[model samples]
Target: MAAETAAPAESARTWLVGLVRRTAFAVRAALSRRDGRATAVTVAAAYLVAYHLGLGHLGLRAGAVVSRPRFDLVVVEDPVALATRRVAPFQYEPVALLSAGPVEYLFAPVNAVVGLALAGLVGVTLAVSVVAWRGPAACRIGAGAGAAAGLPGILSGVACCGPAFLAVIGVQASAGLLAAFRWFLPASVAGLLLTLLWVGSQVDPAAAR
Candidate 1:
């Protein structure tokens, strides 16, 4: 009985390892194509913009009339250190402020860097999914898989500013609840990775090529 259970567990581990390897190969193959590259770039850029806007790092002024467009960038004296400080869950202190026309942005290096990394992951996952969708039967996967996987990532960005987000949603924030919000980004990242692996496992790299 012990050997039977152990054998099944070992087989499962072997299958999971194989799946991860296949997924890596599929992602590489997807990125090698022109359409996949274009899709990833476009999605990543859009996601980044949405993320910054959602975090209030970038926004438009309401009812503010500007006679002419203007631009300004103001940086703090100790920007590097400030950028490392967290203002909220997955959110960093703004080391600079930028104003262009009626738009304003708080430039947080860590936040921008992290957001970009997440956006890139989402973009790549979607790109691989698209490739699988368009590939032959052996490589095909459901087109919606990537989109569904990316939803949590988007939510994670919007939830990074916990208090503000909670207020918008009319949810009362408690000490415990606030602390739980901090895990959103990490959880979403893990979800994305798992979903990406699953999508990759479903695709045959040879067929994708």
Candidate 2:
């Protein structure tokens, strides 16, 4: 029994390793061009901006009038400790407040890092999907794959709002449902990774050449 189990486990491990290798190769091939890099950077920036806007960290303050153009930064005391404070699921409290004209931005170091990381993943996935779809005729992938890659970002945006967004949609936020919000960030990351892996697997390395 032990020998049989070990054989299967070893086989699974080997398969997973092979899949990762292939995916890495495909990703490299996808980002090898100027267009691919441009696509990734643009998508990532857009996603980051959208993500922050959804969280209300970066937005125009309502009913705010600017008499004079000015920029201000207010940092909280013990900012390093406050930066780790979680205000909501996957949402951290801001350690600093930035004001410029009618716009206000909450600057949380951890949140910015997390948002950038997620944006990068989303950007790379879409970039890879584009290459697979349009690069070589031989590199065949699902028509919906690229579109599907955007789903995680949408989900994460909703997750950022937590119960407030759900309430607006007329769904009651139950205890269990509220708990699920905590997993949205990690789940979205997982979704992006899985989608990227699937997209990579579909692209033939030779075809990418």
Candidate 3:
């Protein structure tokens, strides 16, 4: 009876291992292709375009004057005020459809450029590490680490407020967390560099030299 149970468990483990190996092989094959770099850049550009046009808006503020028997007050509300009040880098509230204007057109390109830069850096790092190690194992390790490092930055871009992953995971997204959001880009870059270094170290020292 114990042998029967062990047989099924061992078979399950073997199946799982095969599935992982096949997935890794596919990913490595895709990344090793000549057009892989171009594909990465195009994907990065698409993400930026989505972020700019789909997620961003331009807003204007308008004020109303109220007169009382004894006093007068002017109440104001607008995009500027909302932006100021929100501690998050991006606004959590939905932008009105009509609010987007020339301002969005002007700023969207800038944001896209920044996004492209970040994505390009990641792609280059992955490519270089793969080349340095010259193996599917290196490609798999580098790609996994690179993706992990970029998660925070990607969440920062996608979230209406601060880092979306933290919020989704039930973290409060405190002031410190919001501030740390800005560091994600640099952190990803650093992580990629470390991945490359680690992969290089794993290689034959004579070959690495």
Candidate 2 residues 39-127, lDDT tens each?
78998999898878777789886666878666889999899899998888878889999989889999989889988998888788877
lDDT of each: 0.75, 0.75, 0.45
TM-score winner, 1 or 2: 2
Model 1, 95-170: lDDT tens per residue? 9989888898999999888988988987887777666566533235555554554555455554565666678689
Which is the winner by lDDT between candidate 2 and candidate 3?
2
Per-residue error (Å), model 1, residue 178 = 2.2
Candidate 1: clashing pairs of residues: none
lDDT of candidate 3 over 1-209, digit per residue (tens): 99999999999897655554543443444466665555555655655554454333332323322231222222234644432343345333332233222222323333344555655645544444333334434344333343433333344344332355464468776787677766655565565555444443333322222
Candidate 3 regions with alpha-carbon error over 4 angstroms: 1-32, 50-104, 108-113, 126-174, 203-209
Could you say which candidate leads in TM-score?
A: 2
Ranking by lDDT: 1, 2, 3
Candidates 2 and 3 compared: the better one by TM-score is 2
